[model samples]
Target chain A: DAGITQSPRHKVTETGTPVTLRCHQTENHRYMYWYRQDPGHGLRLIHYSYGVKDTDKGEVSDGYSVSRSKTEDFLLTLESATSSQTSVYFCATYRDPANTGELFFGEGSRLTVL
Target chain B: GESVGLHLPTLSVQEGDNSIINCAYSNSASDYFIWYKQESGKGPQFIIDIRSNMDKRQGQRVTVLLNKTVKHLSLQIAATQPGDSAVYFCAEIPSSGNTGKLIFGQGTTLQVKP
Candidate 1:
């Protein structure tokens, strides 16, 4: 199963509200990534972590932040949710960086901001 | 923005037929490319990957073709099935770094009709 799960499969929220999406993996992968998929933008990376407590911003990291305090848990937080931020968020993990074998992904979390 | 595909190109194919989805990348230094499939309300799942050193790679029912000369990549699905209806994305990894930062292209939506 690769063992990756995202909490709150579907959520409807209000604008300016704070939301957090959690990604947990039983594999204890070293790399974790957060991405948002929109209608035409494909999937844009928000943030990623290479190791515990080490993270970096992705191309579309303006309104989003991420924290990875453990090997199996990565959290994506929205300081203030907006309508434009409504999209399907996905979390992925990898065992190795050099190996392009595969990135195990979660089922995805769908968020709609009203 | 190094490379962006705002308008995702689409391909419609009949069931039992073959399907091909193409992508063009910007970074010539990218050494690894991957193909992912994302069904409705789900995260992108790994399909296949090809390295810049190799031109083609095959999976059980899928093949990935990489043209380093034109910086183009294509994914071919043999015997398109109804379950293959999904959005497909192509991602590239920089050659120099081992960072888990992957540059993704706008995904192509494949519609398989019976």
Candidate 2:
């Protein structure tokens, strides 16, 4: 868990609704990432932030947008939720600079769009 | 589209026996690989990681092996216990523009029979 917390652990909303998931970390990490998990797809990177206000898109970033106004918090927002966007979202922070892939993930937020 | 995949969707093993989970990646350029364990109602946790420079890496009771020529990776757990029962995923950091964007395999569910 590494002091990482995600708000709205579970949410059920209708399609076309707006949904926002929040990830907060207690430590000052240089890297933070958002990933989504589906049935057939293990986990796909949605977005990531290297530094405060510096963010980049990932493998499945088409329907999502992210913001990192502060180093401890990264937010993912779906302007208009779709059924396809219903999945479990995870937020991770880098463990070591040398091994960038090593991450400490949060509990995850489950969103269901009907 | 180069993707990571698992040979078996599920693996059943007896307690105290060793278990091996295999993964394959279509992208040979991927250099960094990692394994994650996810239990029910929890986020994925980092297990181990290996760089392309080395073929094998070991942790407390887990080992990760990478075969670059065949674009394959495997995780071996010794003395499998009930706590070790979870879904394991293999992820790779593609040697591309953004290495932080890790691509994950579908995952293998390890069921330890008591």
Candidate 3:
């Protein structure tokens, strides 16, 4: 079973357009994290959620925003797409609130800003 | 500027031969570390993990070794195969303590020659 799933597996958008990627989980994990993967940068965290309605910034959260309305869903939004934001986005979840070491990740969402 | 880093960007090994990928971390207080493998067009998958208290851990045909003195980590794959060709990354918890965050390293690509 897929514990976590990301929507819009592949998306191509233009600059200045708004885009939203959805992450849904069936495991009911209390913590959710959004990350972007680039060629040489490996994976950089964008934002993370500790609980419903609670979110925090990460290493590269300057151009991204995230919202967790429910325990099983976390949404990432790009106000305006930029060429620098073209990347493969991944969503991860963990069951323990204190243990963020072991994370279960989703397949990923590839976003291309053209 | 303290982050996890890898020794090489790519490594080519013949099939049925042994392969080793190395990493170094700046955080001396980081007690928990994890290794992840990512194939092309896919999100990273967790391979194994090690703690500072322990020097080594084994999983199937893979082994992870932690050298706290040198702040180094290595992953060894026995009898490498084509399926093992992927990018490997090392991640560690912040030295400030476990605040539910992980710092990922620049990935090292392992190519298994047929």
Name the candidate that leads on DockQ. Answer: 2
lDDT string for model 3 (B22-103, tens) is: 9999988886889999888877888898877889999999999999999999999999999999999999977675554678
On residues B1-114, what C-alpha lDDT tens digit does candidate 2 reach at each position? Answer: 779999999999999999999999998877688899999989988899888888999999999999989988999999999999999999888887444667889999999999
Candidate 1 lDDT tens digits, B74-106: 888999999999989888877756565677788
Candidate 2, residues A1-114: lDDT per residue as tens digits?
479999999999999999999999987777899999999889989999989899999878998999999999999999999999999999988744555477888999999999
Expressed as tens digits, the lDDT of each residue in A1-114 for candidate 3 is: 347989999999999999999999998878889999998898999999989999999999987999999999999999999999999999988667454367788889999999
Q: Give the TM-score of candidate 2.
A: 0.95
| lDDT tens readout by residue for model 1, A1-114 | 679999989899999999999999999789999988887677788999999999998888999999988899999999999999999999988887446747888999999999
Residue pairs whose backbone atoms clash in candidate 3:
none
lDDT of each: 0.86, 0.90, 0.89
Q: Which candidate is the best by lDDT?
A: 2
Pick out the ten consecutive residues of candidate 1 chain B with the lowest summed lDDT.
B1-10
lDDT-superior candidate, 2 or 3? 2
Tell me how far the alpha carbon of residue B51 in candidate 3 is from the true structure, in angstroms, after superposition: 1.1
Compare candidates 1 and 3 on TM-score and give the better one.
3
